[model samples]
Target: MWSGPRNLSTAMMYAFAARGDCAVWDEPFYAAYLKATGIDHPMRQEIMTAHDADPDRVAAACRGPAPDGQAIFYQKHMTLHMIDGFDRGFMRDCTNVFLIRHPARVVASYAQKREGPTLADIGFVQQAELFDQVADWLGRAPAVIDSHDIRTNPRDALESLCHTLQLPFTERMLSWPAGPKPFDGIWASHWYNAVHASTGFGAPEGPLPELAADYRRLVDQAMPYYERILRESGRNPNSPA
Candidate 1:
């Protein structure tokens, strides 16, 4: 699955990891992103040190045999990580699911932790770019699940996504143990505290943060792409694939 920061991506990762047949990978391309861009992210040194920094090597591993011979390898990816020169051919072997949230929410949530995040930082443009490329490659749009739908009606939304990927929806996906797992990225401590504290989806959030000037500009910059993907995505949570 591809998503931006502060989306329900970690939650979705835990959801899939709950399934016995699935082996989950969290933000496999993150180290590569940091290495390529040389951006100063929280835990940047630790992340780059802990994970492979070569995108080609990471891509090779992603397309390699599923770990421990698991039936499904659920790769949780950030669209922004596919920086220039990153190979996308590995995606053809996998079912790509795009998970999106409103750009306003993403901007607000991200700003709380990191300051001055541009549109690129939140990944709305990169996501739409990849979505279009994948759609053209597949001759149709891939499955997409909005964070709102998942938060409000997870079972229906996940069932539809599973149908798209030709997998079964398990009750186990609805919940999991409240803590980190072996599969989590080393940066999880900085990024995953909320998810680590949850057994399942948390209660619906109340009013979102009031965007600062920079964040509001980012939202404006990203809205077009977000709206485009939202229209192309599978909007009905209960629809068959």
Candidate 2:
């Protein structure tokens, strides 16, 4: 899934990985790519301090046993991480799932995260820029699901996603046992909150107390672009943003 920082990306990763037979690759190639590309990202130090994803090993990991026609494989990725010197085909060839939240909520969550900088401080504009870039690359046809909507009606939402990915619908996909699963991104505990730890769908969370108003404002701005993209692609959400 393509996601931005502080969104429910990891939790969604957990949700996907929760399936007993899925092979989850949590930010599998990210750190090595970050080091390879040499971007001055705020999370650079943390990434360096965190897991060291060896690039060569990353290639092997990304090329894990071809689908095997059994479990759904999950790969946690960020749209922002596509920098120079990385294999762009990594995301394009995959079943491309996009997870996004209101920029306002992202900012607030960044603050609570105690990460180097708040989304307001750096991430809001930067992350959105990367988001636009990924969208452009994916064209208007990219598969996207609002994190809010997923949390609100996960069964319906993820069912649609499975349809998009051409995977069979299974009730087990609705909810699975909670708790940490394999390849939980290093960021799992810090940002996932209690909601991420659970298996069931939830009342769309993320708009924080401090950013509720701003969240609505940004959501309004994003709606037109989102609507246009969905319209052009002819894939409307059961509940449009």
Candidate 3:
């Protein structure tokens, strides 16, 4: 899925993994881009700290045949990763999904997870630019989900997602059975507390801690584009980022 920073894009990746037939890869492009650009971001560092190391290379490791030859493959991607001078190799040869959350919650989650940029830290125009790049790939008319809705109703959200992808909605999609799965994103543990804390989708989450004012301001600035995407996503008003 194409997304911007601080969205629960990774958790959504986990949710897809929970469905049990999807071979998930979290930010595969990240390690590749890091190798290519020698650049770093805070979350990127958290992502690469795993014992195996080198997610970019690891992404390459999964490049061959599909696991089980029947499972869906879900990759978590970021908007900024598509920037000029960044690797674009990941964009080819794939059906696309675009996931979004209110930038406010994204900013709040950013604050909670790392010491770096707030969603507000980057400003709306810049965020919009990133979204535009993401939108280009996802299509002006692609599947989009609001983080709030995802927090409120995962089953319906995922059911609709299944329809959009033209895949069946299995009970497995709604929940994870006990087993080991690798969800090796840079920020998984740091950002996944809320997701792990849930038994089922609950109410639409309110703004995250300490981000109310910024969330409101961001909402005002971002509402127009977001709402427009909502009308075109052909998705439940609520979907996970």
Candidate 4:
């Protein structure tokens, strides 16, 4: 799954990991991204030390067979982590799905964890770019699903998604044991507290949170990219659905 942070991504990861046939990889490019960019992030040293910091090696692993010989490999990816100069050729080997949330919610939720994020930090632009890249390569638009739709009606949303991927839908995707899984990245401690405490998707979101003007402006910049993908998902962003 290609998604931005704080976008119900962890919950979705847990849902897939719950399925017996799938082996999950969490943000495999994260350490490589950090190592290449030298960006400051929580647990920077530990993350680099603990995870593979080589993007080429990580890409090779991504293209390799599913770990433990599982039938499916579900990778939880951060779109922002695929910075410029990183080759995305590996994506063509996998079925790409873009998971998006409204920028307002993304900015609000992300600010709670890490402050003053730029447009690049939340990944709306890069997501649209990757979506377009995949679509171009496939000669059709790839699957797109809004995180709002997933949280509001997970079964229907995921059922539709699995159908698109030609995978079987299972009740096992609905809930998971509370707490982190063995596959979680070491940075989970800094970012996954709420998801760790939950057994499943949270209640449908309340009204979009109010944001400070600066953050609100950031949302304004991100909305076009979000809405563009939402349209490909076959949902009009303006619709109540």
The full ranking of all candidates by lDDT, starting with the best, is 4, 1, 2, 3
| Best prediction by lDDT | 4
Which of candidates 1 and 2 reaches a greater TM-score?
1
Query: Residues 84-139, candidate 2, lDDT per residue (tens digit)?
Result: 45655545446666666655566556656553352333233434444455668867
lDDT of all predictions, in order shown? 0.87, 0.60, 0.59, 0.90
Report residue 99 deviation for candidate 2 (angstroms): 1.4
lDDT of 1 by residue, 1-241 (tens): 9999998999999999899998888898999999889999999999999999989988988995889899999899999999989999899888888998888889877877888888889998999999999999989888888888788788988898898788989999999999888999999888888899999987656565677786788788998888888777645423221
**Candidate 4 lDDT by residue in tens digits, 105-213:** 9999899989999998999999999998998998888888888888889999999999999999999999999987899999999999999999988878888898999
The most accurate candidate by TM-score is 4
Stretches of candidate 2 above 4 Å error? 33-50, 56-60, 66-70, 115-140, 193-196, 206-209, 212-241
Model 3 stretches astray by more than 4 angstroms: 32-64, 68-70, 115-140, 177-181, 207-225, 231-241
TM-scores for all candidates: the values are 0.94, 0.70, 0.70, 0.97
Q: lDDT: which is higher, 3 or 4?
A: 4
lDDT assessment of candidate 4: 0.90
Error in Å for residue 87 of model 4: 2.1
